[model samples]
Target: METDNKESIIDYQYKALKDGKSIRLLYLHTSSSYHQLPIEVSLCEFPIDACPSFGALSYAWSIDDDPAPSDRELLCDGASIKITKNCEAALKRLRRPKQDQILWVDAVCINQADLEERSLQVRLMRQIYTQASWVALWVGDASTAVDEESGLPLSDLGMDFIHDFAVEIAERTNSGQALNEGPLYQEFIKDRRAFQYSESEVFAPRVRGVWDVFHRNWWKRLWVIQEVALATDPTLLCGLKAETFHNLKIVIKALIRSEQPVDVMEFNSLFIAHTFHQFHVRHMIETGTMGKISPPGIKALDILNATRNTQASDPRDKIYGILGFFGPPATDTENIFPDPDYTKPAAELYADVSRAIILNTKNLDVLSSCYGFFKSTVPDLPSWVASWNDTPVQYFDGKIFNAAGSSTVVYEDCGDKLLMRIKGRHVDSVKLAGQIPDSIGYSNEACIELWRYWWKFASTLDSYPTGETVTDVFKDTLCWGSHLDYSRQQLGENKESFNAWLEILTGTDDTDIAAKRIFNDGEPFKYAHRATSVTWGRNMSITNKGYLAMVPIITKADDKIVIFQGSKLPFIVRTEDGTSKLGGPCYVRGMMDGEFATEEDAGAMDELEWFTLK
Candidate 1:
């Protein structure tokens, strides 16, 4: 007979494994009882190849820092150990009523108390998931309440809507009505009867059900990307309902492509889902399983940028969690990255990875990722090193600019490991920085006031440099010369869109009427979105040289703008105590495409000054 008493039980201890090839598996005993029953599991060691069939479990340890206390007990190997509320919920749902279930759960299978064992187990994570029979992705328990009309559990209703949405999308795409061919979400919103959605609003019960499903914490964790991508087959579980990962991927990709009713948080979920889907697709393309052309290979920089919003209990996992996407190194010694070492400090690990990415890519695009310096939380981090643990700041694509022209990066030999010395040309100083409004896109009146202020600021200049009207330059600067899709374009299209949008904004004194006109129009809010996206965390400013540009919010009145060798975008550096500290990357309108290198300054690219960044 088994009993569940905390005082009478001893905590389970983890046994050491033989080698890197060895792993532990949990065999959960079955019982015909509710989820409240005590969890009984036994762990056994086996070589990865020789282990019994098992399903890999992917889940978040806790959604937030203040997780519920670990009061639930798990009876393991005739002893007992406490587990998180989330882990207990997942195991209770996973256990079958008959026979036994074998699972490879990270929390239970790996010895968390032993740092060495953790590092070794993390190294085997890729192989463990890939070799498993299937991967069980547990989002969390569903709401216990049933829908009033449908009598279905809230999670079940949501999953039903999601499954049906995927089927409809697949059918439409196959029938030549590809949802991605154009603005499908907008069209869908217009014709609700076509998709069988009610004519009332976008957030009907079923539609909101879909939203709630994507909003789960499982979608936001950094580790699930590798787990789902590596699994041969993965099933998503919420309470008692289940869905194939394939179906869920379909809806997620569709949602991201359409950018429909989903807001920022939901969009992040879509991003995570899209990222792992791309990872799996890339693998299939490489194995020749999918006979189709593949997109550009994913790089370390791309992974870092994509997962910036994701969270990790340990900051070191921010770098270590995604290493599985890079496949095994040819040999242990030749590996581009050292094995995940839990012993190193988070800042040191971040610095090592930052250096490796620069050496591997041979570019400074990664430096742009060092944007959150003003609000960074990482201690002892170099000014140039990116703190991936912070909230993601504005990201400017370096590929769109050639600010430094054709010069390649010239690395200087710096004695200190924390300092990076580079050659750059000091372009200009910020003469005046405009106010960064908190309500640019969200408030119509606020947008109009801010726009009026910026227009007045631009009028202070006598004339423009590029031979264009002040109107065109001001509008282009507002949108960063990019369209709604973030594709860089010439002056005509964005200028027209901004003009039409401004006409409505200024046409009426009543903001409600103006806002309605803007929103009620076809593909409304496009111009405002394009502008706010560029200006959200940035400041519009005029340089001492009369160049109109957008710099990071951290840019001050006297901050110096410099174009570094081999860097596509210009850098803003603040001087203190005779040494320079990086403010962040910026966008100078005329200087983006080698316009800084004029015909008058012969060999200007060769005459770069050295600045040591601390």
Candidate 2:
């Protein structure tokens, strides 16, 4: 009359004459049907193999769950859970005949709020599930259950501990198997006997299809592994891995689960986790350390970490190699950029151009590669605001974010097999355009040098959290990725000092409202700024002053001052502006000073006569 899969018992029934080989499922007729048990049968008469028992009967799921563990007690629902009369009836149908029974379940005993305790239990999983008397597999949706009831009936269990349809596993000794000594502990060996609660299709013992219920949180991934160590092959656990057969199950299963699994912060650091590569080679770099991952992100990091160490000696060595660019271990300077808190909602861009050439391992490249590296390393800012622009904004970590005025980066998108035009960052426009060609003849040393310089800049993304200054970016221990000839690369005697920025924007004084509006497509672009100068008319004309013509004028408000031809801008130089003034500084003051010259009327005055007005 009944089959083993009581959860689906109502879907298809046995004919008493012919039987199916699979676990026959019992389903309820109406979705409104609450929990109920099969007709009474004594413990002595409990058939062992493939027969339905009170525990296997389909019933309504009770709202009340298992007790919270000590660790999660704080997260417990105060122990008062609502249960419908339907579930009480189901419980009466399964209770032991006037006897006591111990139940083991994480939801009821452990505290969900205690993160530390929960984390430990999650790490120690093998000892949890296998030690129980019997594990109750609750397949939530009745429509998703499978059915099979062919083999001779002889199955077991003593308690009517099914509070509604959910199984109340009886507690027992801790007898789960242990794992081999390793750096990190994994879950139970799927083949072990202790967890042979379900009949596996291809392998030996199997757990139920759905082993653990979901509790959304990054810390819970560990708990999920701990709680349900076994699962029947017929059902799927995570949405991503349920349909696949590959045993590279850890990442896939965790990815399959609908939640964040690991501490994203670890990814922000450039690591050497080359599981698929040689352990000693430089290989991986994870970007950003906050929030969750989607299907795309999970797969990308998996591939990156998997291939990190193919060369060997410790992939970390490669990271050290990358650090070579910041220059000799030196003193710290104030960083000009802002430190972006990765924990907030923003995007992260990571690129690994640590590719090897015939002899050089440096990442020197053309604009295409430069843009790729720049975009990849930039934290996930809005794409619309990314790309090349006329004027640049300061990156949080302060590399120049502007692109050149009239150039774009070009690339071939293999998907369309067509060429595309994209813009470059300001530095890219200045450093990568037409310089580093696609060839490696090594002749374009200028561009090559710039490429290496940019790589040095990119590596600093790894150090952004510390608010380290840009001058010290390449100097940090984590900044270098390859070797360099520092002697030749030593930026000459002078460098962009901290005070230069102070004068650049504020001028000599603080009241100048003088600023230029940078436009893109004739519209104000987000976060754009103009380069202000700080020149003085005398020897002080170094892009920092207002020209008074009589003596020298130091700017008070804006740094760059304009020598206007009476109310209009006459001459303005951009910061570090190399453009020479087309004409000499002149005073148009004689008439403006109201001192009219009515004396010189001689036609074709000679050079001496011209000097008279001067």
The per-candidate count of clashes, in order, stands at 0, 84
For all candidates in order, the CA lDDT equals 0.71, 0.22
Q: Which stretches of candidate 2 lie over 4 Å from their true place?
A: 1-102, 113-120, 144-614
Candidate 1 weakest lDDT stretch, 10 residues: 289-298
lDDT leader: 1
Q: What value does the lDDT take at residue 247 in candidate 2?
A: 29
Each prediction's TM-score versus the true structure: 0.87, 0.19
Per-residue lDDT of model 1, residues 510-591, tens digit only: 7666665664433446676667566667677899988887778768899999887767788888878867888888876788
Candidate 1: the clashing residue pairs are: none
